[model samples]
Target chain A: MLLDDAVLRAIMRGLHITGSFVLFGNCVLQGWLLPAPVKPWVQARLRVISQGSFAVLFIAGICWFVLQTVDMSGAQDAGDIWQALPVVAGSTRFGGLLIGRLVGFTLAALALWLGWRRGAAVLAGAALAAEGWLGHGGAMPGPVGTLLLGSAVLHLLSGGVWLGSLPGLWVGLRGLDMAQAAVLARRFSPLGVVCVIGLLLSASVQYLILIGSPAALLNSGYGQLALLKMSLLLGLLALAAVNRYHLAPRLPMGDELARRLLLRSVVAEMALGLLAVLAAGQLLQLAPPAMAAMLGQSGG
Target chain B: MKLVNLIALALLLGISPAFAHAFLAKSDPPVGSVVHGAPKMLVLSFTEDLEVPFCRVAVSDSMGMNDAAGKPQAVPGHPNELMVPLNIQMPGKVSVIWHALSVDTHKTQGNFSFTVTP
Candidate 1:
């Protein structure tokens, strides 16, 4: 099947989010979870990952912008798209916000290059937060709109903390000795707990507003995509639980089998996280049941 | 606990309201109604603020000739309302077709008709 604009946009959104998660996730893992006095080699590996992630964000962000401008302008020719580009970038609200986000991304890159990992992460987080405005969360009006935007920001950052950190844990474990690996694992567990709670709570708030009713969850296309995302997250959580409760504890005792299993589980959790992100990317392109109902009403 | 702190933060920001999408809420020269004469302009009220440049309205008489004098413009101080001038001089069934893009980038379009009795 020919990939429609929505499908292409979804793919770009997924890639964009993956980049943000890795950038912000690495920052959190390095700043908060990993034991102080991190090895230079491990930091070097993370730096490479951060740079690669920045590249993904820039490329994917550009693709998403081009697609949205075309869709908004209904431009059928390259010349029309070119003409629309300046108007879109300078005149439209979405374009204005995207320009601001581009600035944020640039600052994040500078911070990363300067070896200010925490500052890079903060800038990345701000860029990700701006995404909430680009989607339905930003379209909402009034005080409730304020709350929805807040929930969107919380959800993205908390998710970044969890899904983004898996690679960090793996890289750290691979390079460190058994004792240090155990310490890293333990330190990460509490952070994971906090993030999971944040994700669930913020998601619930968004669901109530977006889905409107429980029945809609099974009925609407947006709701179905959301359900798929939630299921993927549940799978990730189960693997995480096994890694935390059953595997990490055994690592301290020098159980070779447990260490192997924990590493494998972390990889599996990352896969699930990526799939969940893809589902959410598609979900953003669709109007929720509540909004869809309004869209259905036409003067004709 | 860190979990409690995170949960509390999420709850603090969890308030929600109903959803929104721009749609034609109402229009002057009300749909399918009879107006004594050609109104100076047709006004469309939408449920959300619109991006004026992308919005347009076309008024066509029974012969399919365009009756709209100019492009639609947002009413001053009311971003959700669009006003388009009409060029009709005689009584007939006139159709108004419109396409609008809300400030949020949601696009919606529709058409309606009203009778003109001269």
Candidate 2:
């Protein structure tokens, strides 16, 4: 069954990652692109992506929480809720991450509420940044976690702007005036550059977290999947480069071929993003590189 | 929406107490039961499936004596229940304690006492 218990867990992980990507992507678009002229259309699209993903993420998150609680070991039952609360609050790094994630989620929800007002997009972006921080970034400890958290915030903000522009590009290609499309392209390109930089930075931090030693890249499944994700991201970057350097500048010519090329490249990038999301889901189940080594040490 | 949020908050608060893993529900010898003759075996029942490898059941006499037949062995096909055979029939109060590290990494312990009379 596609929805079997194990599959459900995987699916929950996938939904969480995908939702974060979409939310972050949209926030980037709203914050970076969406020049005054195209703000309305961009805002509408952002609303759809953000709210829709949030609903799915909320439901999947609830399901995951239920499963975890129900399957907790009997030892957890010894304490009352008041007692358990402190234990859960104090137990593992995972617990702290979970609490942080909840706080981030609440912030995101508040940002969504504020989006109907002026300058609310910035607030929404901040909330999305926080979301990324708490989700996987907070899974580490001390300085490493803080670095991950900051990089993730920047990564999410930039990703939001970059990925959020896809639909806009699609719409622009369909029937929008050439001059207006060119204008939007000009506004988006620089932001896309900045977002790419942030993505690369956060991605490097995540890789460091996952691949402790160069040897682990070959030794562990987590490292292998991480390598695969890195390859896909590189491919995406190459496509973005083509779009930025080759295709974007030719928009004034109203060339259908260039538009199609951009569209195809964006589609490919989106596919690669999906693969990255799946890899992330798999990675969640695997121990971090340092932890894996520690386990090996204990066993040996 | 406000009401829905309130309901959700209530549910979250209410359900926090319900999180529990499989626990020892009952024991065959029964806690503090006094009986004549040594028990043949000790059987433990739990609330959910257990990873059997980590489970152990022990029988100890009044002087802190271990009366294990050999070693704790799995009751084939019943992962949740662990059994250990008794070697000697003694007429004394005995304590049975179960210890296990569950699959979820939670450590579990449950104990009961019974007495053998002459």
Candidate 3:
């Protein structure tokens, strides 16, 4: 039997959150070829994780797209979805962009297998960025649309570079040399700063366009969820700060305790970042104040 | 490459013709206007084509009277323009509430009131 509508929606939401983490996790691994190939065993295990995440991301993405077709077609039953799918994919902007994501990600996955690390990273990042186009920003008109989509896309990719890279940082820190770990930490700090700046600017533009008034942050479901996401992001940033100023300096001095502490903070940061992403998934489902009559609003 | 073709097509289609959720751009009788007589129909222009089945428009007067609005229709050759026939005789302040579902499945709703001095 087919799943209930609620069940399918829940599955789609879950897929979005999980797929983002995993797909970006795979992307994160490519920056420096973590668990380097010189150690064949570690590299092999990392590849397996990469492969599994890619598979999950692909499957979940397909299911999510199919659900959207059913939604747009207003299909009452599974059988009708077959007829609706072609029209949706051919005609709608959402469908076309989604197809583009599918293709980009597929190529990214293929490139990863072919050991084209740099190319694969770029493809995956672009795919991740493209998802922002399916959100509220991409639906706007004229130069406003261009501005919003560009900011939102950059916001997403910058987020990926920051949060998506955390899991890999944890892995990279494992059984790690003190000097090398310190160097890695130092190297990422500048990139993280740039991403933080990018995220802040883009998020402001998005809030202006989507939420309209700052008052909506307290009043609407969409605003409330965004509030929660921002709270979680701030929590992550706090943890990151602790790791950056307090612990990282100690690592260069061959302090084992500092290394462990940094790892713990990184883990906490990653966990909070994941929660932020989950909140984002929920926000995407809710209707922004800019639309809707404050009741029965729909947009995905 | 297929990916390139698909991305190019998506960019061209999205950037040129479509944007986001269908927000009410303008409406018949204009919002909160004092008109001389009762208008026979309500016209709504949105930012995007609507999914007419789920989209709805209604006009109700202050004196607990509801006006008849025929099935909402897309204007001839105008996918973005929606019109609903309205029947109103005795009118005071006519309240209009519209809920629109864009063809992309985004839904938006709002309500406004207009005075009909008759």
The 0-to-1 C-alpha lDDT of every candidate, in the order given, reads: 0.81, 0.58, 0.70
- Candidate 1 chain A: minimum summed lDDT over ten consecutive residues — where? A291-300
Q: In candidate 2, which residue pairs get closer than 3 Å at backbone N, Cα or C atoms, i.e. clash?
A: A24-A160, A25-A160, A28-A160, A28-A161, A29-A160, A29-A161
Most accurate candidate by TM-score: 1
- Give the residue spans of candidate 3 off by over 4 A: A1-14, A21-25, A32-38, A294-300, B1-20, B27-44, B48-104, B109-118
Chain B TM-score in each of the candidates: 0.82, 0.72, 0.79
Candidate 3 displacement at residue B7 in angstroms: 28
Report the C-alpha lDDT of model 1 over B12-76, residue by residue, as the tens digit: 77633355556787889898889997898999987666777778788999989888989897799
Better of 1 and 2 by TM-score: 1
What fraction of the true interface does each of the listed models get right, in terms of native contacts kept?
0.33, 0.00, 0.11
Model 2, first chain, TM-score of 0.75
Best by lDDT: 1
| Candidate 1 Cα lDDT to native | 0.81
Model 2 agreement with the true structure over B1-118: per-residue lDDT tens digits: 3323433443455421110233566666666677677778877765334445446677788888788786666677765566778854568888777775333333456667777888
Comparing to the true complex, what docking class would candidate 3 get?
Answer: incorrect
* DockQ metric for all predictions: 0.34, 0.02, 0.11
Cα deviation at A184, candidate 1, in Å, is 2.7
Runs of candidate 2 exceeding 4 Å displacement: A1-7, A36-47, A70-120, A131-140, A172-175, A296-300, B1-118
lDDT at position A4, candidate 1? 91
Scored by lDDT, model 3 comes in at: 0.70
Error of 1 at A204 (Å): 1.6
When sorted by DockQ, best at the front, the candidate numbers are 1, 3, 2
